[model samples]
Target: MTEPLRWFTSSHSNNGGQCVEVADAQDHILVRDSKDPHGPALAFPASAFAAFIDGIKTGELR
Candidate 1:
């Protein structure tokens, strides 16, 4: 059986209207708008999401 998604926003988030929520969904990372919890989400493979975060940290995503 699949585990339930435990969604959360970033701690650095200031409750602004542009925030997004993220969750771990087994092999993928699920992302959705905070304003629409029941709305559609975009999923990325775990490795891909990790690489994306690394890129951001290194300013490669800018």
Candidate 2:
């Protein structure tokens, strides 16, 4: 059985009303719209998400 997702928002959420919530689901990272929690979600591998975050910190992602 899988555990329930515990979604959280980043501290940089004051940049207007647009934001996303993220949750860790074992092997993947789940992302959902903060405006519509019950809406569709996008999933990415944990490693991939980590890489994306790293790229963001390094200003490598545009």
Candidate 1: residue 23 Cα off by (Å): 0.3
lDDT (Cα, tens digit) per residue for candidate 1, span 1-62: 77789999888899675798899988999999999989999999999999999999999999
Error of 1 at 57 (Å): 0.6
Note the Cα lDDT for every prediction shown: 0.93, 0.91
Badly placed stretches (over 4 Å) of model 2 are 15-17
Candidate 2 global TM-score: 0.85
Give per-candidate clash totals.
0, 0
Worst lDDT run of 10 residues, candidate 1, spans: 9-18
Instruction: State residue 8's C-alpha deviation in candidate 1, in Å.
Output: 0.8
RMSD of 2: 1.7
> After superposition, which runs of candidate 1 have C-alpha atoms over 4 Å from their true positions?
none
- The model with the greatest lDDT is 1
Query: For candidate 1, what is the TM-score?
Result: 0.88
Model 2: number of backbone collisions? 0
